[model samples]
Target: MPSLPEELKDLESKLQHTLRKLESIQKALDESTIVVITDQTGKITYVNEAFCRISQYSREELIGNTHRIVNSGYHSREFFKHMWKTIGTGKIWRGEIKNKAKDGSYYWVQSTIVPFLDERGKPYQYVSIRTDITRLKQYEEQIKYMANHDDLTGLPNRRFLREQFSKLLKETKEEERLLAVYFIDLARFKNINDSLGHSVGDEVLKQMAARFRTVLDQKLFLTRVGGDEFVAVAPRVNYQSILAYVRTIQQMLARPLEIEGREFILSANIGISVFPFDGEDLDTLLSHADMALYHAKEEGKFYQFYHRTINQRLIRETILESHLHRAIERDEFILYYQPQYDLFTGELIRLEALIRWYNSELGWIRPDQFIPLAEKIGLMPKLDEWVLSTACRHRKMWKQRGGVEADLSINLSASHFQIPGMAKRLLSIIESNGDDPCRWEFEVTEHIMMQDSAVVYENISQLKEAGVKLAIDDFGVGYSSLGYIKKLKVDRLKIDRSFIKNLPQSADDQAIVAAVITMARQLAIDIIAEGIENETQIQLLKEMGCKGGQGYFWSPPISETEIELLLHGAE
Candidate 1:
């Protein structure tokens, strides 16, 4: 061989050094990256050590097999088509892909595929460089899941609900089916959460979510919107089918739950709105459903369907509720007295005080309109205080001028008793007015007696101990147990007006009245039939051995001045 020239020798040395650098680069890539070389038709020709380790496959097993051996089926066929089209044209394709290993575990990779081209600009082979990003992908998925699900119950959350609502709405409309959106509020959930700790509450919520899931069909979606409130969206076949599904949910949730060795019987109030009927938009539908829920809770119904009248009524109530906070400060409240008479002799025995509101902006709002509103708005305690103080003031006025010989009966709100030591506070109000507590009767609904609260029990006990008379108003219409009546040692059972309105006519009402009277007599408790409108009802009550009654027949709830006139006639 001829000896090389100096220029040729230096050029060959540089070329050798450049080859060494390229080899070093290849070695570094093989160690760090999952590298694979494939023929133009996608037959795997070579796989680096990193590719073998990540794929849990030997080089021999991966080679000549193509990348399909690691296909996870996560990416769509179209996704792979796009990548192949790009690489086939001698362009680099960069993307993230999910692949399965030989052990059947899935891994994610950040991949870049570069096509080696012939001089004709056609691809002859492809080299793929992939970075194992399985952990990062998992972390991203975890973040996405946490953002869309509730932490306590691990249920899809409100944001997820909103996102899915549009899709569900579109599907329902396309199928010409009704999409039912159920807004569920767990009744008495706050009481449980407050009495028992949040840990117990959280466990109860989780159990509730699990039970809810068991009842839901695969097409139905349940999301925990917030504390003790969940929403379910489902496509229904018809009105009847949706109602049947609602009943099924009610029945399922009615089953008793146990947590931390304590058994709980829970109930839910559900409000529903249907797409294309109640509303067409997500926000409108959800708003209407929430309005229906308010009415469900207000009317004490298990579930309520959305109607246009509910929105109107809710709007009016909302306006009234806004003004109600100032009604007390504005002195818009007044009390009217109705005489309770002895059934046989027509002698006035007691005066029932009824509250009425006369707002300046909204004139003459009925007690039926604002009393429950007061209770709902947490104004009952303050209103009760005003009633107590005002009643005492009126009695002091009546006694100073040839007094009336009748006990003053005032209706007490259930929420008033929820306040701790409220009974003592009320007694102090009566004492401060220099009135005789013995001459006053505090009447509460039978529902109040059924509340399982120490504060309510203590309040009732304190009132009874202070020589104030206790009466169970609306006796037969509520959930008050016979044992509760006996336990409270109530002085009177006021038969509800419903039974009295159709008395001596409807056999059911008559039987209920007679049974209640007999039960009250056997319990050695006094009974009064209210809403007495006719002599026939009065005569029948006398025959039933009822001693006292009050109704519109004798006198409608009257002003204090009119009550004084009735007192003069009685005297």
Candidate 2:
């Protein structure tokens, strides 16, 4: 070898420094996230160790191969075309991608691709950096599914329905194809849910959804919009076809469902709306369909086609909902006290406080109408509290005015009972009354008791211990099982009006009433027969050894003044 010049030695030193720097860069790339360099044709030119590990392929196997080796077949041709259009212009493309591994397993990656251009500003090579996000992708998918679907029935939810409707509206061409929207409300679902509990209710809904799915083909979309309510959208169907489908659905729903060794007759109220005829938009179509459903339910338990008249009712309901909150604040509610008499003594014993809503514009709105709306809107707890406190205050006033010794009975809704601190609130009201806790009776229906026995038992037990008498209202009509009655610590059993109305004629009704009375006697619980409209029914209940009775036969639900007059007269 010849002796080296000073310039050549300096050049050698610089080359060694550059090699050290390049080695460090390579080592860093190997340890960092997944990085790959591909030629202009997308053939793999370089892959770091992390890339090989993530794809479950060795560097030697991946280096010479094309990127297609990890193809997951999830992306469409259009997707790749658009991606290439952007990156081929020397721009960056960022997206989530699913890729197959060497072992035939699939993994998701959050990928970013940067295209490198030649000196002419044309794409020459592409560099992609990715992070393994398979687990995170799965979690996101799970959350999306939960948000758009019902866990119990595995059906699409209201949110999903709205999205589908929006998509349909965007794609629909006017006068080209018609969309049929069907609103189905289960006829006896609440009754079944009340009698059998929510677990059985959930099973019933699942089976019902399955049955609904079986009757429709791939073109239809079904969603559960609310408890006991379902909506179906059938695409490219005319009015007549939609009506036929509705009839078919009604027939399927009429079939009996066997649950927990009980045969339950299923029925649905269906309402139909046609696109461009009933409504030109999604909201209008859904609104009309719901209106038609209400009409069907009102007319009979079957199907009905949409009509213009139904729209008016929907508008009215919407107005009601909008103004309901203001109605509560405006004190549009009043309490009516119906006197309950002792069957043996023929003396007024207690006055049951019934809520009545008197709207200035709508006049006297029936409790049946607004009470359920209140429960649905989550206002029942507040209403119940107001009723309790007001009735207690009224009872105190009546006692001070030389009225007969009478307690106040307030009806408690199932929703009200489910609220946390309900027992404490009741106790506080009773304590504030300055009266015997036993004098304040709380009337709860048997349906409410069957919902969650453990929670209901705990709350009722607390109320009972605090001196509030617990009475099971509408007793014989619901699932009045002995187990629940015993577990509930009940002080009174008020027979439902349906049995009382039949009285001596129907043998089955007589048997049911007699059985309930016998059970109450055996359990040492007092019995009160409500809805006693006739002398014959009253006499029959008295003969049956019922303890207390109240109905129109005594007097319709009266105001506090009227009840006071009745009590003083009885005294």
Candidate 3:
């Protein structure tokens, strides 16, 4: 026992060297990424520096703490249950997880967890390695947003709407709540662009988007389905609630907008469709809402609830819409002119070019019904081009006839303003028609002027340079400011029918009309009052020094023949 052999002494030195290597490995493990070793029960036996750094806890603090110490509460309890089941069966589990740091900050990590088995293949300890990937997750989110959102309005695009609609349909049950889809189209946005320019039109769209946001709850999902058209999806709401929400939105939209010192009163036509009641699927709901929206636009401004009759009308509309896509190619669209009279001189001053669609199956479809539908479906631009080109041709023809000069006013929508090269396109249309831009008047709403002053200014400047006349139609209903009015290089302000209908009776109404007339006079802007029904209203407006007036009291919106007859008699 006193003396050892040389071989035994050599074995002892080897053992000492092996122990040193093991100690070095243990030190390396302590500094590695989220190195964790736990007992089968998931009690922490060891945690590394990296784990402490990510979890905001010291090794000592985590050693006695369970895995729950870093739980971010993001994963469901079932997630943890499944994780435990897998590890208990001696399988490795890997996944990305969100965990709370020691200071309550959150981090995302890719984790690989392994369960070690004893000699009998029973569970012993578990080891986990994790790498932080929060930045990567953020980048992924950014890319997703770019793909799903409208670049100009920052609202969900049509693609996103379809995806969300599918998901929502799956999640909602027939009994749980009703789903409603609202189709919104801005009224007369095109007129604004034609007169003031696209820059102003784009500004109007942005402002409208912002106002649309305010009209809904944070939970409401809104999407820009097309130019000047938005779809709002209200999930888990009752019919009453949906109605209330739409009313609120209508009120918000009707609120006057001020831009460049001009007051723009903007109105929207909203159509709504409910789930189960309207359709069981996303496509049907959207289609029906679109149909209802068209009817609302034709009927009047504001919102309209969906009904089954809308579906019948929708089928014809779909046919019309499908044909509209090819209408330009087929040459099935035509321009019809209606003359506007100079009240005092009894002569035709201008002619408004209106679009009419002749479908093979539907006969002649009036623009009052289909133009808004085209706009909601993104066919307005094509329709607008047709109107512009056709009107220019007609104007040239009229000019060739005995020096007959009549200004042409072509209606445009807000969406057209957002299109690139709109100014160039207008100029090309004018040149192609061989018509003078100086004799053309583009009518727009005040809301477009209030949307963005810079864009409005630029577009207006371009149009003015092209020698086009700018007119603000449906005025005194939008947010108008003297400042914006001064900035807008418009020549005319047309009073809206709502004000005209109530004029000379309600003190508030009188004040609004008086104020508008006064403002226009000061700006040297010509005033045209629309919707005069009674003689008293006409007299009141004429006494107020209004320049021109149009209404049922004089004549309803009629054909060129009637307008010519009226004008000839007056002359």
Please tell me which predicted candidate would have the highest TM-score against the true structure: 1
Put the candidates in lDDT order, highest first.
1, 2, 3
TM-score of 3: 0.58
Q: Which regions of candidate 2 fall more than 4 Å away from where they truly are?
A: 1-178, 183-215, 221-231, 238-240, 243-271, 291-305, 308-310
Residues 372-461 of candidate 1 have per-residue lDDT tens digits of 888887888888888889988888787777766568989988778888989899999999999878988888887776476888889888
Question: Candidate 1 vs candidate 3: which has greater TM-score?
Answer: 1
What lDDT, from 0 to 1, does candidate 3 have? 0.79
Indicate whether candidate 1 or candidate 3 has the larger lDDT. Answer: 1
Give a tens-digit lDDT track for model 3, residues 498-542: 987877778998888998899889889988887777779867877
TM-score of each: 0.88, 0.63, 0.58
RMSD of 1: 3.8
TM-score of 1: 0.88
RMSD of 2: 8.1
